[model samples]
Target: MTEGLLTAKAVMERLSQSGQRVVTAESCTGGLVSALLVHHAGASDCVEGAFVTYSNQLKHSALDVRDETLARFGAVSAETVTEMAEGALRAAARATVAVSVSGIAGPGGGSDEKPVGLVWFGLAVNGKKTKAVSQNFEGSRTEIRWQAALYALQLIAGYDE
Candidate 1:
């Protein structure tokens, strides 16, 4: 396990103590979040599964992000990720919490409105209102992805506001 995986392990242990399970959805970060969670022992106590929705189609088909929402807000928007989190909560039958990430990590494909390294995160705890946040990191593609993955784990650990 790497540094982020270590953080994920701590978060998983806490979640296990709380008797809470988490479902993860990833876009630009791929399965990094899921992989980290499962790397440590006792993962089954806190991890349900993960969805790697690298495309809009899979985000819709797997995580239930509506086409209209995607068309209106785009994949990296707070609105889209909020829906993704909510959908993931429903998809993971045993999970009571969900986290979703969408972003652009690239040397290209960035506009002034949504630049590269801009990521949106959505977190939902069952029977609670879902929350979304957008942040921008400065780095290469790999660094940006690492930051996003670590941030997602922080969110799961309740370390982020």
Candidate 2:
């Protein structure tokens, strides 16, 4: 099995044991995190759903990402992903946890401040403070996206309570 699948299985088992369900809001990874989670057996028991909010408009419409937040932070910032995660939790009634990913996984979309392969991840767990973190990966666009998806699963699997 791939690393993503392994992590997905672990997350599924953990959430199932805790009676928690997960929802994903994806930007750059394009639902890859959600797809990996559903690869596990009995995934529907732990996965609520996914939102492929690739565009900023979709992010706002589907996940309720704030326009002010987007204008201030852009699409790939910690603030945006945090709002996306929290909004995902609000959108999915059954989801106890939400993971949001936003990044520039590309060969062109690079800058000095927020270069390509820079991914921001947000995790919002019910009754816990929302968390955001960033990772700078070095690889092709596909590889960066894969790494981001794997890391999102890790975030879910490593959540404490």
Please report, in order, the local distance difference test score of every candidate based on alpha carbons.
0.91, 0.93
- TM-score of predicted structure 2: 0.97
- Residue-level lDDT of model 1, residues 1-161, one tens digit each, is 37897899899988998899999999999989988889888898889999999999999999899999999989999999999999999999999889999998987878999999999999999877899998899899989888999999999899233
Clashing residue pair totals per candidate (backbone < 3 A):
0, 0
Best by lDDT: 2
Residue 101, candidate 1: Cα error in Å is 0.3
Tens-digit lDDT track of model 2 for 1-161: 38888889888999999999999999999989999999877998999999999999999999889999999999999999999999999999999999999999989988999999999999999999999999998899999999999999999987774
Q: What would the TM-score be for candidate 1 when compared with the true structure?
A: 0.96
Query: TM-score for all predictions?
Result: 0.96, 0.97
lDDT of 2 at 75: 96
